[model samples]
Target: MEISSGVAAPETRKCPECGSAVPVDERYADWCSACDWNVDPGAADPEPGRIAAARRRLAQEYGDQLAAEMERAADGGGPPARDTATVLASGISLLVHGMTALLVVTGVLLVVLGWETGVQPVIGVLLLGTASVLRPRPVRLPKDAPVLYRADAPRLFELIDEVGAAIGTTGVDAVVVAPDANAAVTGYGLRGRRMLLLGLGLWEILPPQQRVALLGHELGHFAHGDIRRARLTHGALHSLSVWLHVLAPMPAVRLLDRFVNAATFVPRWAVYGLLLLLDRLTLRASQRAEYLADASAARAGSTEAAVGLMDRLLILGSVEAELRRESVAAQMLGGRGGREARDRAEEGLWERLALHAGAVPEHEYERLRRVAARRGHSVDSTHPPTHLRRRVAASGGSHPAQVVYEGPRAAAIAAELAPARTSLARRVIRDLAG
Candidate 1:
């Protein structure tokens, strides 16, 4: 083993509240997503007394306010009636899919007619093939991939069921575990089946109730029909984009490409412009979805738990990047210690994260909330600022504390998947090494 002389590395800017590394490039942002810290030295400070008073008021009426909000939502008095944006987006999707289907059908009809009428229809056949390619590809999962099955992880499934019920959702079709520090709910298959993906890196760090809140938040998306609407908007946009890219003329064939591109320009631009407009129109709705999900999560779990989950997500990005760069990559660089090395590194990284995971700073949260309200999603942020979500969650109804397997039981659950987690960490480390 080669041991180098000890040397202190250059100091880097880090989010003081969350302890997450701040990229030199992104340091100018008004607020830190990690802990909502005002990262920019020149950022204006909010009035101290006003913020303190607001926080105190929030703490006092948080539960009752959220309960009333939830009641309003249940009564259909919350959130704009999904009309304007959904209609526009769904309309555009329908037009694209409809046109593509028509072209394919017309091509097929021409080809069939040609056989009887002795008219050449080669172009028609080609059009049919092109239309088929333009359609969205089926969602697929790799065979024999290491997924944490519901049967093997009964405790996890049970927890999901409990939280799902609380969030007004039914069964989850599948669950997948990976090494990252996050979780997401995705739609799978033609029938729109739901799959919950959990990151072991995040799971190991969170307490049991926090995990429930996280799950509740995700399941809320399903209950609120956000998943279905997203499939229509995002999925259609993705498929149409792929089609356009494939059909776009190559610069290499400049002379012929110009004519081809000119012929297709109008339709292509129309689709592109529609998607952009859709994003703009739905910005508020998208943000509203996040707030509503936070409410559901708070209702299912405790206010504290939902807030804790949001805080962790905001901060975990930097923590995750650091773990990949330092502990995981460092161990991988050494001679193969196999699964043992990966396990040790993972445990050590979790400990480090736990140490940094303290109470969220109040001033930081208030500053971020202000920044987010002013900035909106001009930066293409998928989710609303963590501060806003945190505030919304803080003002939610109370629930009995939920503990989903802890102590030895939690350890057993963790141990049962040691091999899988170790395998994933090694794979990630190898990828990073490259």
Candidate 2:
């Protein structure tokens, strides 16, 4: 492998030919053991056809796995059993917690021993104080955004309740509207109360069935209890990071800090490295979770409707990128003020969406497929590649799209949400202009 300048090769690597798991060893730098794919710095690029075929095989592998899992689920198999990744992630989380407990006990003992030996207790107290600093704040949404409660937006709540029923889950605790091209479900507070952030851009474009698919996918995360598991893992990893950040401000105790870090370095790094590995291992589980969510959407509506939602998402992403990178400034930046600027930005985005909707050429989709295939899976990617997801969606036999709501009901939901969406747009414009 040709290592980047000033950076060493990672402890693990993937096989270039098949994208299969490569067993890590001292010889990993030389070649992939799984497929014997060598990294030759001087080798000329291979033909595009060979690379394309390799990527296709990798995507097919993922698609096949998903298909078999879906088949088993359909056969009345209870939810798919926890795989190796989930188990390992749970184990790592427990290990982190255990280490934290060990630190607490050590600090207590040190304080007791220091008092008995006529040594100052300040040192021990300091260590305990550092532990206190490790308490993580819960994740929160932007406070500037407009939030709607069930009481405030009964019609919107009704819509949420309707979608939740379709997906076999309860409605969210709160909903926040934002100016963006995406929507998400997250939580805040000790109880991890679920909050949904709805993007106006997404809401404006989706058909009723596609809207159901979108809502189903978001609520599916909550129904499956993925949020709590994610929080546990996040808390474990973040505690370590908080402690590291605490250590950085102690220049007066540089020697002490160095000594302490040296003593704990290997253990600390082992934990960090293990956490990263766990992330990699659990990535497939995360992707599987996404697929399950997609399946929920399909079950709630039609397979075709769910695929349509995904297709719209693909097109939206392309248009959003184009507007943000190439066209937004020219149209929106020279405005008299933030409101006009915001209006221009929104108009530009909508215009582009209009241009592409049902009009994006086959060549555009082919280009998107090619890019997705080439991109494959990255270490940090939480979801599967778009092309692979589209393939999985297509694999399910077609069914008539379910209509869970009439036009009037859809209009009621949109009408209730209009004010919040407008407020969000204004806030975004102000922020951008400032």
Candidate 3:
């Protein structure tokens, strides 16, 4: 076998913090993740013994966390009302009821009040739709793929099989590394279908255990059939909501907003109250989905490791926020990510947890565009806030962690976030759900 060499070469030394190869620069002094232990830089190289010893200790600690996750996976009931299904379900029911009423009313009006013909208004709306289509805005997608492809796809395939063997899963359908910073799992739940999405950023930065933890959580989503259920439930509601939006006289607007600002108080108050209730209910459904995804991820792996994953997401928020503040225009426009989106298909559990914990750095406000101009979706343009995800990944739920994920150069190159990317997911879901 080739002997380890160079700065990156595995010497008789390694960082106690991460198992990544280190050179003689810190012969004895190394960072350790398992115990937060540090070695002495002045000491001699003991790669022969220290490395194995460190692995042993770290493995034990990590294994314990993994075991707990496995148990939770077997016994935990996916997500509860916290998963947001009930609220979404209610919203759908209510909206459908209203739509049915409107459809009936509109149908009657077509017969009596609209032109004398039975189909006048319906035809009118369809004609308007056709007109809208003809005048639709021009589309512009980046000529380049969303993200640079990384990681060996074949290796991912092999690992999927390995994970299935370890956990008794039939395995996932496809593993895609998003060129974008966000990740997700999507598929219709039928006899044989499943898909997984991972951010290219994730592959560039995550520790092995944290990466596995993420995969475990994803697998849990699969085993529990959460993806299928979430998709079906959401698709049904979304479709119905869209139909309602089209049919209702004012589905998208808050009743009060239509004229309340102009004058008249009582009718406006009532409409505001009704709209508030609906918003709250819809928000609750979103919240529930988030919680469920978190619980599902926890079921798959060590809760602690899952928690460790947050460090990077928090860093992402800070990075974007810093970017946004770089320019006055960005501060005004705030068009960028700053962070959060669980999936291309749906919200993820990570961001939700982070939001619940208030993970975003304070400055992640309107000024995010400066950084967004370049990094944009790499951090800002996505659906959720970034800092919160970092918080959730580092801490569990709203609770915080004493220590969190950080890169090999966290202290030196604050801009780089190789160490904390795994943690962004949970925080994003939490924020989005909220």
Question: TM-score, each model?
Answer: 0.71, 0.70, 0.40
Q: Compose the digit string of candidate 3's lDDT tens values, residues 357-418.
A: 23432323212322222221122211122233322333343322222224442233222222
lDDT winner between 1 and 3, please give it: 1
Give RMSD (Å) of candidate 3 vs. truth.
17.9
Give a tens-digit lDDT track for model 2, residues 99-213: 7766667778788877867554666676677666664567676787888888888877787776678777888888888767778887877888889888766755666788777
Q: Which candidate is the best by TM-score?
A: 1
The candidate, 1 or 2, that scores higher on TM-score is 1
Total backbone collisions, model 3:
54
For model 3, the run of ten residues with the poorest summed lDDT: 376-385
* Winning model by lDDT: 2
Give each prediction's root-mean-square deviation over alpha carbons: 10.2, 13.4, 17.9
Q: What TM-score does prediction 3 earn?
A: 0.40
Pull out the clashing pairs in model 1.
none
CA lDDT of each candidate?
A: 0.62, 0.63, 0.40
